[model samples]
Target: MSRLFVTGRSGFVGQHLEAALLVLPTADWQLIESARFDLLDPASLDAALAETCPDAVIHLAGQTFVPEAFRDPQRTFEVNLLGTLNLLQALKRRGFSGTFLYVSSGDVYGRVDESDMPIAEHLMVKPRNPYAVSKVSAELLCQQWAYTESWRVMIARPFNHIGSGQNESFLVADMARQLVRIKRGLQAPVLHVGDVDVTRDFLDVRDVVAAYLLLLEKGQRGEVYNLCSGVERRVSELIMDMAHLAGVTVTFKQNPGKFRRAEQRRVVGCSEKIQKQTGWKPHAEFSETLLSVLSDWEVREAH
Candidate 1:
């Protein structure tokens, strides 16, 4: 049995990853989480690494929310950048050299030109926000370790992933929740939104977790792969889809507060690298995915 340690087990993707790991029939994986260690607490981290000495690690623990990162850049940097440094040092002190996957955001490729319709790994990264900047910094840091040490370090830049348990701070979840409320007559038949004209690449959190596990087993060391569906979806269309799924007719209202700083107007990513190598691509149907999200909100509202 291979011991696998994963950070950020409390986050949305982390939760899904944990669930995915639990049901895999092909491999025996002993999953370890960060309940006993703090990323900033090197002593605890060192002790934890010494104890577990995980055969592989997926580092998903970091400040991911853009607006929150803007509000607290220092804290974001401390967590995303310094926290990763601490983990690396702890692993080094423990003489641990294994596959280390650093989960990064597609936001790092901020402000891509429209000509670059489907972003690839070779394109230059222009980070436009604190959250994205911090991710890029950590990506480089982990890549550096991959080059210097024998660790199989890989970086995954996942695009906007949506699922049942996601909070309303994001676009799809917020719209789904609001539509659920509108269906239940808990709120008005109106949707408050940001720039709905913008487009993004969406993938199911189920598919995203599958890709992460595939990468852990088959991904090339010292390389970065983009994790996305390769389909550009407009936020307006998504809102419409969710409303239809929730059986609601809604009017749109502009919410100025919903706008994020340095928000990319359009995003689509090419997962060809991961596909050709690992034979992985998104398999969830768009409408089915939306229905699951809507059902999630419906169940949440029932409680």
Candidate 2:
């Protein structure tokens, strides 16, 4: 059986990816999560690589909060950038000759031009926020590893991924969680929102994980692939759709404080590269994604 070592096994994406992998039939793969403080302790990480000797490492552990990254840039870099370095170094030290999957974000293409509609992989990276900067830095680091050391690496830039098990801090989850509360009367009928007019390429976490697995199977080493829905939805429309799914009459309140600086008005990406390479296309429709998320929240609230 091939062993897969996942760095952020406890995160929302990590959890979903793990569950998805459990059901695959063609491959018998065992996923091992990081038990040590990844960025802070190098010795512990080295020990894990020595023991697991995994056939692949999916690096998912990092500081993901954009707003939080703005609040503490140093902390963001410490985890996203330095943490990635630690993992790469550990893998090198342990002499693990396996494919490394770097889970990056589409936010790396910050403040894109209108002509860059459906941003492609070749676009120049212009990270506006600390979170994007950190991800870009990590991507560069992974590229360096592939170029200098000849490590097999595939970088996946997944756009806004949403589904169940996601924390309420995220936009879609926040809307779903708030709608659940409003239905249960646990909170007011008011839903707090930041910039609802912004458009983003939101893909279901299921599709994103499938793309990751596809990358592992058919992706070219030393290449960067995008995982996107190729469909952009306004935040306002998403919340309204989610509210409609919940069958609730909720009022939305715009909280300026809740808004983050450097918020992009529109963000979309092209998954053509990945699709052409792996023949992977997203199957979940927007309505299905919305209803699924709301249904999951309702179940969670009932419990």
Candidate 3:
């Protein structure tokens, strides 16, 4: 049986992917958590790859804070850029010939004007923030690796995917967490929000993982694919959905202090290439996802 290796196995997406991979009977999957290989440590990474000899390496470990990236570009670049370089070096040292799946973000295509309704995979990436710049750099590194050494490097630019295990840093999860407190009367009924008018493409974490698995199995080499729902929803709509899920009337309190300096007004991406290439499509409804997120938080809060 084939073996699979994954980084960032403790993160939100990593947790979902790990659970999803457990049901696949074809491969004996192993999650090499941060303990197994620190992205910053080259020797550790090399040792892990040499020991596992995985058929596929899903690179998901990195710094993932947008606002924090702005605060400390050094840490952002160090973690996102240098960390990826270390992994590439480890793979080279191990002479590991396996399909590599790099989890990129739609943030790399930052601040597209309103004219560009649905951004395509071929559009030029003009990152507006430090985090995005680091991701763009990582993608370039992956491309260079593919052209020079490997042919199985696939990049996935997934839009806003949210589900269980997401922390309070993200908007959806933040809202859900706050709603839980409000519903339980632990906090006020008023919800703090920032830039509600800005729209984004949101996908369920399960669908995102399915797309990643499909790309791992059938995606073409040295190509980038977008994983999105091809639709935009305002943050206000999401907050309202969470409120509806909570079955409580909630008030909103817009805090300009909470807004980021370079917030993109509108963000959306087209998943047509991935859909056509691998016959993969998103299956989770937006409402169902909202309920699921709320329910997941509810269970955690209850516990």
Q: List the residue pairs that clash in candidate 3.
A: none
What is the alpha-carbon RMSD of candidate 3 to the true structure? 1.6
lDDT of each: 0.90, 0.88, 0.87
What lDDT tens digits, residue by residue, belong to model 2 across residues 269-298?
999999999999999887898888888888
lDDT of 1 by residue, 117-206 (tens): 799999999999999999999999999999999999999999999999998998899999899889889899999998899999999999
Q: Candidate 3, after superposition: displacement of residue 81 in Å?
A: 0.7
2 or 3, greater by lDDT: 2
What is model 1's C-alpha RMSD?
1.2
- Model 1 regions more than 4 Å off: none
Which runs in model 3 stand beyond 4 Å of their true positions?
25-35
Steric clash pairs (candidate 1): none
What lDDT tens digits, residue by residue, belong to model 3 across residues 192-249? Answer: 9887888999999999989888888889999999999999998898798889889878
Task: Name the 10 consecutive residues with the lowest summed lDDT in model 2.
Answer: 32-41
Work out how many backbone clashes candidate 2 has. 0
Best of the candidates, lDDT:
1
Query: Candidates ranked by TM-score, best first?
Result: 1, 2, 3
Candidate 2 segments exceeding 4 Å error: none
